[model samples]
Target: MIYAGLDVGSRTIKLVIFDTVVKESLITETGANPLRRCREILAGRKLRRLVVTGYGRHLVASTQGGKVVSEIRAFAVGARYLLPDCQGVIDIGGQDCKVVRLSMEGDVLKFEMNDRCAAGTGKFLEVMAHTLEADIGAIGDLALTASRKITINSLCTVFAESEVVSLIGRGEETAAIALALHEAIATRVATMARRVGIKGKAVFAGGASLNRCLVRLLGEKLGIELTVPDSPQLVGALGAALLAKHEDGQ
Candidate 1:
């Protein structure tokens, strides 16, 4: 039997199909309108069960009879399934960030989330990069070449952009400013993770994990080694699919 999971996030949508008997998986992404895209992706495919998760999950119609899972719970399950030794998860999406601490069995121990602001999320980096006239995709590599840390004092995205512009006016190297941005984001996320008390092996998920500079800075700030899954952004969908199979069993 095949189980399907859909994670409809703010910036992107992800889908994962898991085969029960063979334990194989297929993962894909659809930029927006997740519900419609999911339907189109699953056309003619026989799925034994389906689950939905993420911030935009409620937008998915209940008429489809798919089970709805919280993004936090789904991430916990996905992290556990992929990295059985994982004890915590740090997921930084486009607009929000979450730090989840789990027991050895993958049960939630504690968690903290920063959804009210974009300071610690991917959007902040995107905006900063745009302000610096730098490519978002190249920020990581550019930051690595910096010789000094340029401080970004503002946690507010608007104020931070203005700060970056001011730094540019001062003839600061973009690399230094980029390093500062990543460090700022790392500091914000690390502070949240400390509230829940990071434990054991940690797994970093979501699109931001793809940023090497952010990952290194975050790990350094948290004082813990972090692991990234093959496809960090798909972890939620994978968990949803796993939940679909578990639900089918009951």
Candidate 2:
């Protein structure tokens, strides 16, 4: 069967087309408008089922005649499918951070999320990248080469930008400051994960999970090796696809 999943995230929309019988999947990302982009992507596809998940799940759910699943559930389902031993998931997106505790069967046992601020989200890194005049993709490599550890006093993106400026004025290298920013963000996210009671064999997902610096810092703070999906950003969509597959069996 051909199943389609749409993840309508705050900053971007993701689509996944899966051939369940063959266990193959195709993923794509577009702007935040999931309804429009989903229709555009599904135009020529012959999908037998569809499911939606993520921040804007309800918005696309109605249009696609599909059910809305929580991002935590979807992420856990997708992560565990790819890494069956995964017992925890940490997802840091554009606007929030989520930590989900999962059972051996891939069910969500407990979860915690921080949607109240931009401090620990991908936006934090984006703002910092702009302030440092550094490429977001290169930030990780630059951070890895830092000679010293600088403290970032503020977790607020605006305040952090100001702190970065002050550090630059004090002759601190951009690489060091950037590394500190990533470490600060990782600390916040690690705290959230701890609140949910993280276990070993954790999986990190979402757009920010692709940031090597943040992932490395997260691993260090959590003191656990994290499994990253082949396409970290597509976990939600993959989970949605898995949901569609289940519904078809019913």
Candidate 3:
């Protein structure tokens, strides 16, 4: 029997199929219609069990017929699978940032999120990068070489963009602006980690985990080296698929 996990995120949909061994993994843009995109992604797949997760989990479960798991649960499981000694998990996705502390047994102890806001998420960085006329990923490289961190007063996306414009007008270096923006998010996420009591190396997952600037900034802020999976963005889906594989009577 085959097991599958589907993560329907705000910006992308990730799928993982497995049973003892991973058979396939894929990611595609969420686009305008997630349901439609999901259907397109699963056109000819067969599975004995399916697990759905992420913000759009309920929407997909109702229409697509699958069990649902919270992002927190799935992430913990995935992190542990990749790094058995994982003490924490941080996911910086398109719409929100999440931090979770875990037990050695892979159970979720505590978690925190940004209240359904785009304050320090991938979407927030995308917007800031556009306003700065810089490549989102490339700016991280620039930020690394910058010496000073420009203070980003507001975490709000709109106001931050305005702030970026004013900085540009003032002729502030783009790298400084990038560092400031990255600092804002890294600082906020680190605070959440502290609240959850995550003091050791944590698993950094989700799309934003790909941002080198965020990785370095977050690691420095937390004062701990972070661990990232080979396929960080698929961690949630991978966990869900593994869970489905373990479900009885599959």
Candidate 4:
């Protein structure tokens, strides 16, 4: 059967097409407007099942024929599919960060989210990248090369931008500042994880998890190793696809 999953996140839309009989999946990403993008992607295909998840899941569901699942549940299902033993999941998206503790059966036990601010999110890193005139893809490598460490105290994106400018004027190296930015984001995520009681065998998913520097910083702050799926950004979509199959069998 051809199963499809769509995750309508704030900054991007992720789509996954899975062939259950063949046990294969094709993943794709598009800018916002998930409903339109999803229709565009599945236009010519015959979808036996469809499921939606993420920030704009409701809109996607309204436009498309599918059940909308919570982002936390979708992420946990995706993480568990990737790492069957994972007990916790940390997903940092463009505008929010979530820490979800999952049960052995892949159900959410507890969850915490930071959605009130852009701090500790992918948007924060994007702003920092713009401040340093650095490419978002290159920031991680640059941060890894930093010889000195700098501390960024402001968790608010606006104040942090001002702080970044001041540090630049003070002759602080860009690499150090980049590392500091990752550290700051990691600290906020770590604080959120603590509230939900992060456990070992933790899995990290989402587009932000693609940054190795941020992953390393998070590992240090959480004081434990974190497992990342092969395609971190597709986890939510993957979970949605899996759920679609499960519902069909019900």
Candidate 3, residues 1-250, lDDT tens digits: the string is: 7899999998899999997788899999999899999888877888788899998999888877889999888888888889888889999998888999988777888999874778878889899889988887787887887778779999888898899999999999888998999898888888888998886768999988888989988898888769988899999999889888777454
- lDDT tens string, model 4, 183-227? 999999999898898778889988889899988988888887699
Error of 1 at 216 (Å): 0.8
**How well does model 4 score by local distance difference test?**
0.86
Write model 2 residue lDDT over 141-164, tens digit each, in one string: 889889998889889988999999
Q: Rank the candidates by lDDT, best first.
A: 3, 1, 4, 2
lDDT of 1 by residue, 1-250 (tens): 8898888788877888887532545445556566777677667878899899988677773756688999899999999888998999999999899999999888999999888999999999999989988899889989999999879999899999989999999999989999999988998999999999986689999999999999899888888879999889889989999999999983
Clashing pairs counted in every model: 0, 0, 0, 0
Model 2 alpha-carbon miss at residue 13, Å: 1.6
For each candidate, give its TM-score against the true structure: 0.94, 0.94, 0.96, 0.94
Using TM-score as the measure, name the better of candidate 2 and candidate 3.
3
RMSD per prediction, one decimal?
A: 1.8, 1.7, 1.3, 1.7
lDDT of 1 at 195: 92
Full-model lDDT, candidate 2: 0.85
Q: List the residue pairs that clash in candidate 1.
A: none
